[model samples]
Target: MMELAHGNEVYTWPGEAFPLGASVKQNGVNFSLYSKDATRVTLHLFASADAASPQHSFELNPSIHKRGHYWFIFVGNIGHGQVYGFQVDGPWLPEKGLRFDKDKVLIDPYSQAICFGRNYSRERAIGPGRNMDASMKSIVVDQSDFDWQDVMAPRHSLNDTVIYEMHVGGFTKHPSSGVDKGKRGTFAGIIDKIPYLKEMGVTAVELMPVQQFDVNDAPQGRQNYWGYSPINFFAVHAGYSVENDPLAAINEFKTLVRELHRADIEVILDVVFNHTAEGDENGPTFCFKGLQNGAYYITDKETGNYANYSGCGNTCNANHSVLRRMIIDALHFWVTEMHVDGFRFDLASVLARDSNGHPMKEPPLLWTIDTDPILCSTKIIAEAWDAAGLYQVGSFIGDRWNEWNGKYRDDIRAFWRGDSGTVSRFASRVLGSPDI
Candidate 1:
């Protein structure tokens, strides 16, 4: 507990802070961020979508910060989609492994829509709290909604499955795609073109990543390119939604699934739980790290620096219960609620790492997923290796999971390139599982 020399209410709080995001049980929203050496942190609230011009921003009284380094203040007056940024002030000592730049406006780790650019330089603010409603925090947008239609899980058997992996954008971005000019490359666009997908003989459509992420990271067209970096696991990409109403887009996605079910098609999500969009100390703070730094990441216990296991920079200590739950709930929501077929885990081996960065012989996370009753029928495909050089293709085959068979990618590339002996290796991959 940090005991101030003097008991003084540093700043007047408008309301209480809620956990994660605005919640029904929440009387206020909790504002949190990670900075091991940060001296001060302020929550800036904008009246409009303009961050350069905050309507009113204030620093929380130091007395309110919890042991977990969280600042809880009741912020009842603010509605959802309220553009916010964090200004953290601390030592800029990099050699000591700390990069605290108060000048750089940090994003809320839990932000649903990550606005582009550094600091106030833009007019449009993007982050999901709930700009669509002025309802009480109790009126929080249910990322998970109730549907009585049916609990139709896409049990796509192995031999029958023809997985068509494609980007939600690329498929429609091509002018020749013949998609509706308005609905091009959107969730609705995909739904609109589901018939074409059926016609192509694809039983399962494995999406790159529909999870909300920072497309703006590639705003200049440089590209975070592949949607490998995930921003919010729970929220679908706002840009991909057919309409501005994200909830409606979700319902429409569900409807698309229902329709596809009638036609016997499945939706597989390419999920990146190995790491997040938050690159490193250099990248912006979007979620888990901001919620709980040391807890959510595998920090160098000695130096308190983040470990980079997923190649994305900050390796999520996926073994952590809270973060692990976030990953699990996201998948469960996709499968049980949205009726998704399965998940292809990018960098599956990282999930096998313990919080301390050691590879566990039997990682609890992998085991639980393999045996989850709700996910028993779910098809699990692993990228099988990670950027950290943990290769487990045929090495780490678990029950009920399929490794991506990277060897297939290598051999197939060789064959298409007209390399010799490719035919024999291709036969083995086609005939059997990479399991052995």
Candidate 2:
């Protein structure tokens, strides 16, 4: 038997921060979060994903749970599939660049599975008041539960790569897709179409943003079809899962990857690390904004407003030490846990900027990612430009990074459109743009 502190029948213990997310240990679940300036942090536990209120709440004592920049707690009798969220308290002065609202429940930045309800409303999260019933919750999932059945990554070299970039939902959502109504537009649907991909001689499928994104993040009358507005970097999109259960997305996603690997096909996720579904100043409060706004985002030096280098109303502070570690940790999770082959960064140029929004000659985030031991063998690709017109085509620092070759597309289009005497430029593009 293990000793545990019980207050009103809520058992708790101190947790470490080596693993940042909520981890299911042998005895209980360890919850950890990074908040630099937070004075107090509270953990809320719910009976279900869509519970209207918390079943139990524990406010972590700073002396016991606080260590450095991380706040953590180990709750006894809580294991896998437990639904939880955090409420952080601090100064709410937005003009000073601090937007901490203790009432807004926040998803864990390191969550492996996210639980969203049909009635989930981002609008209710923007201002004060508790929004537990209307907000998204994080589910504690065991990362080691899946059985790979001796499957491994294809790990095809970049020189021999034949990438077929496509969207996950659009691949089979249409009636012309000829898939079963229930399996259409799901990870299982992709498994149903693997034969066609094999016949086409494609080596890898560049999945366009499988990370959990906001479907309602569009104009009032439209939907976000491309999935550029991501909400959680760690969880697979719940919309692509079959059953409404919390574990369905995680297991089905792993099944898709394992099945693809069996056919000698590689999986590359197109990740958007620049901006999130949470947009500018008027945007809703999610995980990062509520936990630590000044650390997660790039703000104006004088007015403290968001610096929109990503053209998405706000830019992520990718080079910050904390965010950089989170990026690397997310990459390791996909590569080691999910067995993903590579990553194609959307608006990757924004990652090269300094905290002040200026481009860096040697961005620490890029250098760290390039040199990280776990990611050294993984393929890293970049779009090579940002919405702010900061382009780094041939000048991108990392030697291991492959670019999308935007110039080649432009030259090819110009030559085909008969714009001018562009034979030399077109030929160079045909020759892989060595002139670049």
Candidate 3:
């Protein structure tokens, strides 16, 4: 804390921009957040995950810490496990498409791990007043501390892969799962059942979204159990973690990957980059919606409402420069840091849409992922369609990408039911369907 003339103490230093997230350095933690229209940004530090209010809050000095659209700050003496969040002040003009509320404590867009208390509520973040107690806090993590023991992605080719798609939660969620009580429905549960997966002779496990998603994203009483409603792209789901600590999820997820690789089993995540848990303009002010709604989501130019291409209410502005870079960076982290083999993009065709929600002939983001040096060897698989009827099974942009083959599924189903004229299509599907 720097002592001011008035005897108030403020802990802060000018931070850099290259590393976007909360980077744990030798001296302290460096936090950098991107906010193009925000007039003011404050860094709030808390003592614990359930801290009702921040112990210390320091406003970023624009002249010193602001670099273009980024508001960054380096705080001394704070290391890993430090709970933090951001508060941005700007115009609340919905018509012009800028929604910033200083009252809402937002999780960092680049947060590797997120922590929420019992009082966390999506309703509290919707309208007015400060939701500090109800807000999700971002934790500072030192990713370099994990010991993989020379473990790496199995790198199983798409041609030789027999993918077994499974849900992480349901894999062990049942009472008859035979997994230990505490370990049930968790990453450790998957580790326990490695023998079974090995016996099945599957090369790759296409995991349904393990990314930190909103469990409360379902209907009035139901819960989002599939993990499709993602809140943080980089974070491992806290519900899957055995421990309450925010860092435990990351470490446990790594342990799952390491153990899977030991058995020569490749891990492929069914990533949901198409839409966030934040539903629409009426949804809660989460990370992306509150940070830069216009930059992150594909908004209707006239209504300023979100374009629902993914049928998830808000379609991500995937082709935009900011989001495109973020998608690549997130993938690189999962590959280089998390040691994941590949990705199966949910609603992969959404990535093909332009800002106006129209399909592009050559989507830059798709081609960029195909040619990216970091992602070149990484298996790129696509669901090959969106909820908006943008199918790209045969016409998907990149040559490296393997499609889900929706036509193959239909044809195979038809043949099983002895449908007429299905023989030719079924044969084509068996031979990799050149006409699909």
lDDT of 1 by residue, 1-436 (tens): 2212223322233334435544322333445443445577766665443334455466756666533545544454444455566666666444344455554455554444444323322112222222211210111244445463664555768889999997987778666877888778776677767789888998988889877666555555465557887766766665666674445556666766677776778888999887776666555544444435655667676666678988667887888776776677677777766778789998999999998889989888888888888788788898888888889888774688888888878877888899987888777767774444
Write down the lDDT of every candidate, Cα atoms only. 0.64, 0.87, 0.87
Backbone-clash count (model 3): 0
Indicate the worst ten consecutive residues by lDDT in candidate 2: 1-10
Among all windows of 10 consecutive residues in model 1, the one with the lowest summed lDDT is 130-139
Model 2, total clashes: 0
Q: Could you tell which candidate, 1 or 2, scores higher by lDDT? A: 2
Which residue pairs in candidate 3 collide?
A: none
Residues 67-99, model 3: lDDT tens digits: 889888888778888899999998877666678
Q: Clashes in each model (backbone N, CA, C under 3 Å)?
A: 18, 0, 0
From the highest lDDT down, the ranking of the candidates is: 2, 3, 1
Report the lDDT tens digits of candidate 2 across residue range 1-436.
1236565354788778768889889878899999988988989999887788999888888888889988998888888899999989898767666888888899998988888766688788887688989889999998787899998788888778888898888898987888898888889889999999999988899999988877778888788888898887898888887774557988999999999999999999999999988898889888988888878889876677899988988999999888888888899999998989889999899999988889999999888878888887778899999999999888888878888999998999999999888899999999988887
